[model samples]
Target: MARMVFCRKFQQEMEGLDVPPMPGAKGQELFDSVSKQAWQEWLNHQTMLINEKHLNMMDLTARAYLNEQRDKFFAGDAIDSVEGYVPPSE
Candidate 1:
């Protein structure tokens, strides 16, 4: 059976992850409160951030920046978008 959680990002009850995405208390919090869909959204946003900013994951500063963004994103706070990015018309 699938697990359920009250996804903080989406603000709705949804399917939960099988395990925390990372180590630490925050990871456990995400596993309990974030949904699979919201997590996938963050992955996409993180990818965009990485590409747009030319972020080098191996660099400590870059990793720290991403971590901050991840926390804000999951907390339903404002997150910066890629510079000069234009969303496609619907």
Candidate 2:
């Protein structure tokens, strides 16, 4: 599971971050530009589904959302801890 920090500003949202511009903002570094784009698209779909379900507890819901999406990526081996907030390791 993962979480979206409430502290994150609107412009800092990861909406376009899956594949950050080269030499620009780095995101999803594990995936190349093309791969990251595809992954982000898939992530959007999953996020839509999660939002549709409507969760009252955002933290728990976000974590589950990320984990669920991770399953679709690497057999669920992607361990992005959305349970806490931290700057991107990159």
Candidate 3:
């Protein structure tokens, strides 16, 4: 059976990641509290933010912004959106 966690983002018990997404305490925290579905959603949103804002991952400010956004995302707070971008019709 897959590991399960009480997802901070979704506020429900769900399937968890197989391993920590990164090293150290923060990664461990996420592994314990975040679900796989929420993590994947955040990754997709982060990628959209990077592409839409033309953010450079090598830049400290950009990384810091992403970190802030990530925290807000997991906390169920409002996050920055890609301005002037529209989703495709299904």
Candidate 4:
């Protein structure tokens, strides 16, 4: 299913679905509950991988662009030391 597709019952068509246990819901309370649960689960699984992939792709693209531009920039894998240090005395 598409990431943006909400399994929500209140979509434009309404699908003529009668909301079960209807109360407190604009159209159907049961639709609200079921849709919420399904969408939540869907979002949890889908969002994680898509977000991770986006971050990974962005980092790779940035590194590639930087590499093509200059070899004098910060080292790709170097650890930068923390400065302004004041160690607590024993």
Candidate 5:
């Protein structure tokens, strides 16, 4: 049987992740509060930001920026968007 959590993002009970997506307290918080679906959504948005910004993960500053954005996103803050990015039309 799948684990269920009261997903903070979806505001409903849904399938939870198999494990914490990260280490430490934040990861525990997510494991406790965020649903797998919501985490996947954040991942998609994160990918867009990385691609559009040409973020270099090797650079500490870039990593820090991404981390900050991730936290803000999960916390429902207005995170910055990829500048000049236009979604493909179906």
Candidate 6:
């Protein structure tokens, strides 16, 4: 059976990640509180932000912006949307 955690983002118990998503305290915090589904969603959103904004991952400012956005995302705060982008129809 998969591990369960009280997902901080969704505010309910959900399937947890098998391991930390990254190293250090932040990763451990996520492992303890973030659901796998939420993590995946964040990754998708992050990718869109990278592509649409043309952010350079190697740039410190770009990385910092992403980190801030990530925090806001998990906290349920309003985040910037990809300008001129639309979702696909079913």
lDDT-wise, the better of 3 and 5 is 3
Q: Candidate 1 — which pairs collide?
A: none
- A best-first ranking of the candidates according to their lDDT comes to 3, 6, 1, 5, 2, 4
Model 6 regions more than 4 Å off? none
Candidate 1 global CA lDDT score: 0.93
TM-score of each candidate structure, all chains considered together: 0.89, 0.34, 0.97, 0.22, 0.87, 0.97
The lDDT of model 5 is 0.91
Candidate 4 residue-wise lDDT at 40:
46
Shift of residue 71 alpha carbon in model 1, Å: 0.9
RMSD of model 2 against the true structure: 15.5
Candidate 3 residue 88 C-alpha distance from true site, Å: 1.3
The residue-by-residue lDDT of candidate 5 on 21-50, one tens digit each, is 999998999999988999999999999988
Q: Please give the lDDT score at residue 31 for candidate 2.
A: 32
TM-score of 2: 0.34
Q: How much does each candidate deviate from the true structure in C-alpha RMSD?
A: 1.4, 15.5, 0.6, 19.4, 1.4, 0.6
- Per-candidate clashes, comma-separated: 0, 4, 0, 0, 0, 0
Candidate 4 similarity to native, TM-score: 0.22
lDDT of each: 0.93, 0.42, 0.96, 0.36, 0.91, 0.95
Off by over 4 Å in 5: none
Q: Write the per-residue lDDT of candidate 1 for residues 1-90, one digit (tens) a residue.
A: 899999999899999998899999979988999999999999999999999999999999999999999999988898998897788999
Q: Model 5 TM-score?
A: 0.87
